[model samples]
Target chain A: MSKTIYIAGLGLIGGSLALAIRKAHPTYRILGYNRPEKSQQIARERGMVNDLTDDFASFAPLADIIILAVPIKQTILFLKELAQLDLKKGVIITDVGSTKQEIVAVAEVCFANREIDFIGGHPMAGSHKSGAIAADVSLFENAYYIFTPTQFTQERALTSLKDLFKGTGARYIEVAADEHDRVTSQISHFPHILATSLMLQTGDYAESHEHTKYFTAGGFRDMTRIAESEPDLWTSILLSNSRAVLDRIEEFKERLDEVAQLIFQKNEPAIWKFFNQGRAMRQAMEIHKKGGVDSFYDLFVEVPDEEDVVLKILELLRGISLVNLHINEENREDSHGVLQLTFKNAQDLATAEVIIKNNTDYHITIT
Target chain B: MSKTIYIAGLGLIGGSLALAIRKAHPTYRILGYNRPEKSQQIARERGMVNDLTDDFASFAPLADIIILAVPIKQTILFLKELAQLDLKKGVIITDVGSTKQEIVAVAEVCFANREIDFIGGHPMAGSHKSGAIAADVSLFENAYYIFTPTQFTQERALTSLKDLFKGTGARYIEVAADEHDRVTSQISHFPHILATSLMLQTGDYAESHEHTKYFTAGGFRDMTRIAESEPDLWTSILLSNSRAVLDRIEEFKERLDEVAQLIFQKNEPAIWKFFNQGRAMRQAMEIHKKGGVDSFYDLFVEVPDEEDVVLKILELLRGISLVNLHINEENREDSHGVLQLTFKNAQDLATAEVIIKNNTDYHITIT
Candidate 1:
């Protein structure tokens, strides 16, 4: 028996789910429907789905499972439209929305008397890039995938739905919808707001002093990278979770004010204590490897800032077949360039350290 | 005749300068001094200086050039102490202090009726790791070395000072004392405060919601990297440039408030416009190559998240002798992993793209 899976919205998440499902269960037929007619064609050409349909009413009745991978507002509107349709009995419906409380609330009302079962899902994985073109079959691998089951959701239907995502290699976790919203708000939504605010502050400073922009090094750029996120997507997300985000913002403001007062009073000990606490807190956090997060073991080498010094070091690393190393030369121009060598894991780092120590006179420190 | 250069403070910056001078101009004798009696012995063992002296009175009169590589307050005290000594005729003096205005003012008074000359210098280079153990001879190559000369500064003395640093491969730029303070406050000092504030904000949020720390990604880590800086060093810097940093903070607060207002009102268009402007501004800034700043031509590739997929790609790259490549697997656990391949230059990036295109089925985009 070939299971039919209908994915509404052929964007990064939707398109990727389709690709992963196809690879995991080749006999299953995957159908995709996107708002922009052109995306359906692109999705098909990329082999993201086996079929594309223009009629949602006809498509709604055919799938054993339906996955809504649209914006939060759009997901609600689509759910309402699906409620009017005669969905298949024992059919399972889920969504990959960032926020869950509002979406799950809509699902309760829409499927109150319907045979379809709804599960609210939020995949904690995405690229900085978007759309079907950026989709991949293995995207959900090792990523955390949260599913919020409604009170009316059936055990068998939930099991079937979980089976559909078995190929994704995701770590499935269950949480209440409200808990989902609150947790995501703290970790994801609030950070985005802070990143944007920091960007605005930096932009304003740069406007007044044009030369200041040139002086912004890695720290400023890293702080503001999230500000370059797609505005339409972020604006929608911010508004959708406005209440929770706003609450976090208030808390953040209080903390900022305390630091500001310390700076104003020129209280050296207080400021130092504040920063020291922050440093310890930050260092204690477990490094996340999913999304667009970087994970590398860093090796700091104290070397002279000569033109060919980095090249010579790279050549030595190459001699040991360690080609994946990155050389950070930010300090090379000012002082003895402390070259930062990045490796994938501890074993590789340890190996590189031994090689450098034995082959060269440079002092190395593992960070 | 050999030129004698006395470097006071055998720390990272000062120690590195001594090593570089010795490497580039071996005949020029380098003398080192530090308040800690033990540091003099360590400095000698490291070969950072040709000689070490405990008596400043004797050391001050035997040099053609004297570099006070100490903290701002210590530099001022050292200058005052040197003023009392019977210094040699035409001895050029310079201090590698972070701030210049106050230091230059003190230098003016200290050298008023003395034969010794003083020029304010701030080498725009340093690493997170401090002290002589982290020093390297090539630290200043291609780095900007800013000098703030007092009104009484002699051109002959300035020329001699410039000649002493010729071997360091630094680009010398002269700016007024106040100008140096204002510009540095905008670029360096103010950013540090903002970074610290952000860290504190995040820390507060994490205290209430402990799980939030586990979700912090690359952006959070990068933003807070500077926050991990030595607290005592940062406290001294922030205090020395308090006035200018405070002014910048006021400007930053005003901008942040406006952003807060936009978020509070859910002004979609305004928020969108703000982010869009910030994105443009951030992208326009010159990419710096110091510290842990990334400086590589990036190529984004879409590949499945299988266990050996990245290894396979690396193997392919290695076959082509592409050893200086950095693979950023930020999205490996989600969607198709968009691996960012970093190359040394554009030409190398182009070559890798061609090789990958010819060898693999993956789609690549140069960013």
Candidate 2:
């Protein structure tokens, strides 16, 4: 049996999802909807759409699964329009919105007493680059694809949706809609707002002072880099999750006060404990991006100002393939350097560790 | 006519400064003082000290300049001790403390109406490594070295201190002590506190929630990386600049509240304007600061994900040196991996570029 899946938006997220779905289920017809005259032929010619139509109300009824991958406001509008349209029985409808509470609420009301299953999704992956031209199959690869499944959502619909998105190679996680909204608010929405605020405050200070511009370090840069992201996009994200974002700010202010009070009282040990906890947590999550400590082994070797030390290490491990090695030139001296070695697998890492230990008397630390 | 300059505390910063100063002014007799035991013999054998002494008071009378390269607490203690029995005429004293206000205040009271001249200094750079052996001359190179000068600071003394530190290759910026503390509290001290707080809050959130561990992204990582810094050093810094830090937090809360209110009221255009202003300011200042960066040569090579490929490049560049090399782990699976090589100067990069091109059939780009 073949299925017709109508994807509403063909921008980066939607088009990428369309490609991933089409690739996963070759028999499923991916119906791409647009204004018909707006790049309709070009999108189909590029093979992103198996079938193209301008009439979503006419095409939505045929879609077994409907994906609303537009911006939040547009997605809400589409959900209302989708609610009014005649839809297929046992259809699974999902939207890839950053915040899920509003979308899930709208979805639940719209799909109530109907045969349709509404499951909210948030593919927690993004790029500064946007639009139809930026779509790619591997955009969601290795990323976390969250599904906010409410009590109204049918179990079988989620399974089918999961099967459909298997080609995306994203790790699937299921949670309540409110839980999803809260987490997104803490990690994404609140951080975005704080980054922007911090940047604005720092900028104002810099403008008023002479040569405060010279005091920036890599930390300042890292803290404020997200402030340069798309303003309109962030505004939508923050507003969509306004309640939770506001809660986060309130909680953050409390936490900030706790730390500031400690600083003001000169409670040195308490300050240390706070940062130490932060360090411990950050360290525990350091190898997370590379899929845990067992997967990627990092070996750091301090090499005294001597020629051919790094070359010798390379020679010893010539037969065994390693991941990466670097000398941080920014802090490196003309005579002294540190060799940072990384290995992909445990076996290779063990072999490299043994070889290095046996061959060199240099101080080595592994993390 | 070699003048004796006394250096106290030989840690990473102190040792590095000693190495740099000795390299620049070889004729200057660097008197190293300890109880004339411990690592005194080892440090002298390593050439970090020339003339050894058991008493700083005895050593103080013979020196033309004194450097307190110790921690903030230790530096302050030494400043008070030095004030009691300092006899050298026109002797300039300086310190390498992260926070300057407290140290300057102590020195102001200690050396008031005396022939001693004290100018506060802070080299805004650091590494995890500590102790005498961990020092590297290039640690301060390209880093910002700030001078906090006051009305009591003699112009000639300032010039002499600047001349001495000319070997560090750091960009010198002069500002008042209070101004220094204010700016540093905003950029360094406040951000450190906030990052640690953010991490702790997120960690608490993660602890309470199930499967929230998978929700982290690059932004989260960037915001929390500074939290991994040494807790004790940050504790001292925060306390030393507590007044300014508290003021900063007050100002930051106002800014954060402004953004939060805009978000809470769902003022779309106003929210957009806030972020837009942030983006513009961040962009403008990013360019303003980075405009001073020296040109570094970059070379990119596309390598297949085969065994021993990176090794081959390393082996080829064994004789030919490189400044930095990185395998962009993000897009490594884009059929082939690209190796990014950076060089401080053109000659080494040119040699490596030629060698890699001639040896491999992979696509190479030089920038």
**Top TM-score: which candidate number?**
2
Question: Would you give me the overall lDDT of model 1?
Answer: 0.73
After superposing all C-alphas onto the true structure, candidate 1 shows an RMSD in angstroms of 6.8
- In TM-score terms, candidate 2 sits at 0.83
Off by over 4 Å in 2: A33-47, A52-58, A132-136, A284-367, B33-46, B51-58, B287-323, B326-340, B344-367
Model 1 scores a TM of 0.80
Question: For residues B178-273, what per-residue lDDT tens digits would candidate 2 score against the true structure?
Answer: 899888887778988878888888888888875556676777776776888889888888889999999889998888888888877889999999
Instruction: Report every candidate's CA lDDT.
Output: 0.73, 0.79
Show model 1 residue runs off by greater than 4 Å: A35-42, A54-58, A150-158, A287-324, A327-367, B35-42, B54-58, B286-324, B327-367
How accurately is candidate 1 docked according to DockQ?
A: 0.28
> By summed lDDT, which 10 consecutive residues of candidate 2 chain B come out lowest?
B287-296
Q: Write the per-residue lDDT of candidate 1 for residues A242-345, one digit (tens) a residue.
A: 78877766666666567667778989899778768767766666322222233446788888755556556655665333324545544543456676676644
